[model samples]
Target: MITSKLMRPLTTGGVLASTVLFASGCKSMIVFDPKGPIGEQQRDLIYFTMLLCLIILVPVLLIAAWIVWRYRDRKNNRAPYQPVWSHSTKLEIVWWGIPIVIIVVLAVVTARYTYALDPAKPIESDKKPVTIQVTSLDWKWLFQYPEQGIATVNYLAIPERTPIKFELTSDGPMNGFWVPQLGGMIYTMSGMATTMYLQADEPGNYMGTGANFTGRDFAKMGFTAKALPQKDFDRWVADAKASGNALTEEGYQTLAKPGTTDRMTFASIPSGLFERIVHDYSMSRGAPPGYTLRAVTLSEEKKAEHTAHPKNGQLPPGNGAQKDAPDAQSLGQPDHRSGHMHLIHGK
Candidate 1:
């Protein structure tokens, strides 16, 4: 070994190694081997925005460096203190106007791609888009294909290049939906709905998980998005339907329970289950039984009549009805009735 007095070589080698290791850990720095159109757009958006940002950033950095170097203090530390010259109309215009233009360009580009990737818009190809209703539960995803009449947990299968429309909502409030390679994240809240559209270009399994932290096992709230050939996807659906365990309303109540590490499957789904889930029927059903009774508003005149004459329509104060004079006294007590008595009492 060559004799080295200074640790400069070893220190420099260690620094270089650390830099390489850290850079390797960044997912973006890795090459894009996209398996979907959504993935391609995501990667392109990253690079395009990065380049646009650098156009302004790099020049500002260079000017800062040049100014620092040129005005650096020397033994002759004479420098002009021109505090009043700090506000330059031209410089201000350049800074503000350039950023505005950049933002406009970015916004236009983003909107174009976003609409192109809209899930509600069906592709014009021969392939019909897969419709999946996704319900986010405490720690799992429930995917129901109404057309296929089948349901699955922790797995979803779609054909490559075929668009998918996911109608998403939560079993409860503690969840968010995301598939990093597919599209942006959306919230999944009870009594509310959100949608996401995506199309994969290759046949493979991609990992996706809930991006929001809910509770324990949030890390495990993941599902496998499988892009299969059309034939394979059809087969999967057929198999699911043939499995025989139908997901009924009662079955869904069990599936929607809280706590974690739960999973369930359905050979087929009961008719109208998907519609019910999407239309917030569960929330409606969960309402108190008597709450369903309509409360008809009484007009001021009607209210006055009801107050003056009081009967079955009026609010009950003491109890039901007094049959006779002695019953009105109730063997001893005077019923406090003036307001409601006329309505309840006949004639």
Candidate 2:
């Protein structure tokens, strides 16, 4: 009667706990519901690690329960009592050897997966990968499709079953780009470019967001990644072109300003826009200047002379260097070497 009473509450508690866990498991988790090859690989790694851990966890738990039940302070119990026992060579070896073997296996699997799933590594696909330039803005994401000659803000569209090569940078503070169902996160830093490759096996809309804490609006820094069939993707590009929105230099300047913005699309974009953005950010550390491109082929002698004596700590100028060139700093323009100048009022 006493044992039955004690077991009743434990049985009820176990059932309650199982019910709660079952209910929680019904919810969909993106990591488990992967839609792409990269995500599947990551999910497999997670499951593999969990199963390996359970190999030790289950045996230890079972042994602990058996010891508690068989050695409990019961009137008729006859379990062995080794109060003075120091150690057992077999037990020690079993415990240590099992864990070491598990570790070795895990390490090998982890290393293999790490190399196979490197973000920068290209996906194995016969189709040519689509290159997308990603720029993390103050509170939004800008994607430029150079091949398609179009751009979109806070929305990325790609063709299903095709590899995507993402070249990422940031115009605002440092941020992380992540598409949970597609692949892992990659950092986007200003003045430096990073690359990641991802793909979707089927048509669907996945949520992409900035995984790093950026600013006040970081929570809202999200975008939609839509994967569609080839025909649909081409139609999207055509529709974007018909929208008549052009991402011009002046327009981008305004759009690049710090603030949140709704989804936007451009039908056309200036050629070499992505390169210019990267170059401008790298060179000026501010907005891109309307500087004229003047290529000068310098002879070896001229190069040596320029290297020996840099003009105003600047690289040797080509023939186009004016004798009385205006000082960019004095003119309140961005200094090529010193970066942008911030003017203080009433100083």
Candidate 3:
């Protein structure tokens, strides 16, 4: 009857859009509510890749609702019409062998959780990780704490069940660093140096952010992690090392320039100020003063005088945007294994 009155307003508009997405609650989905052990091993590898994509989406939605209710548009609808019904080799080997065995069991469960969530490895813990550092300025987020020498800025605290190493870099440009309950999102570039590790197993506060977008005070960067409880993170690192506020190196180059402030605290940081902000972006006179660094390349005779000889060299057209320097410099290298995404030059 006109397809049950057009599926009764498309099944009541998909049950009022799933009751307005279940009344929008999920406690701000802190990445499926994780709280540590690397966000519960990345939420159990996102619930085993959504239970292997609902085993190919519940058998292709119950065989597309039993081939639309056994071939509808009926009046004496005796189903099996077949009308030169194309080939089948057992339904094309059961739909291409069940998506190649669900893509080889999702590439062996994403290469065994990308080496078990390797945001720079180290998170075994009977407690002894802590480090910190970070940086990502121009919008903000400093952190430091080199074994509690202390430093803060947008703020982070750490400790609950221990194991946080971090390190990251960037006085600007590259960004990322997230903390959706305590795991993924790493990045933060500028003259390299990255590494993550994380942990948390309870205690609270969370929030952190800056998953990229660098411009207009990229929504004021954000930061606040907290965690606490190793004697409340050693009494909040002894009240941030007795906040006699120091920071130096001219106050971390005026808190790495470009704006946004509040939530500061120091009490000494500036010995190797995050190893000179990762060696001031491989300085040969580059990324330091007001460090912005989005592209970084130069040299190799200015990359063979900005290459692109197209018309005769051909292939130099569309997909541009790659001036280079996006990954590998592992500052003072000790194999900062964010699985090295290539580009390692900087002498």
- Highest-scoring model, lDDT: 2
Candidate 1, residues 1-347: lDDT per residue as tens digits?
A: 35463577888899999999886776563235456666677778878888899989999999999999887778776777766646689988998999999999999998988787665555556667788888888778888888877888877788888988888887765577766666556777766667777778778877778888888778888888888888888887788777788878887888778766445568878786656665664456343235323221223224445545677385433332221122222222333552222212111
lDDT of 2 by residue, 73-138 (tens): 988868787688587999899999999999999999999999999999999999999999999988
lDDT of 3 by residue, 1-347 (tens): 99999999999999999988875865568798888888878888888988988899999999999999976787876677568857769989988999899889989988999898888889887768878888888988988888778888897888788888888888879989899888899888987898988888888898989998999988888878988788877877788678787878887787788988889888777788788777867774463343222223333223333353424332233334234322233322343444322222454
RMSD of each: 10.5, 11.7, 20.4
Per-prediction TM-score, please? 0.69, 0.75, 0.33
- Full candidate order by lDDT, most accurate first: 2, 3, 1
lDDT of each: 0.70, 0.85, 0.77
What TM-score does model 2 achieve against the real structure?
Answer: 0.75
Better of 2 and 3 by lDDT: 2
Q: What is the lDDT of residue 59 in candidate 2?
A: 97
- Between candidates 1 and 2, name the one with more favorable TM-score: 2
From the highest TM-score down, the ranking of the candidates is: 2, 1, 3
Which ranges of candidate 1 are over 4 A from the true structure?
1-33, 75-93, 280-347
lDDT against true structure, model 1: 0.70
Give the winner by lDDT: 1 or 2: 2
- Give Cα distance to truth, residue 199, candidate 1, Å: 1.1
Ranked by TM-score, the better of candidates 2 and 3 is 2
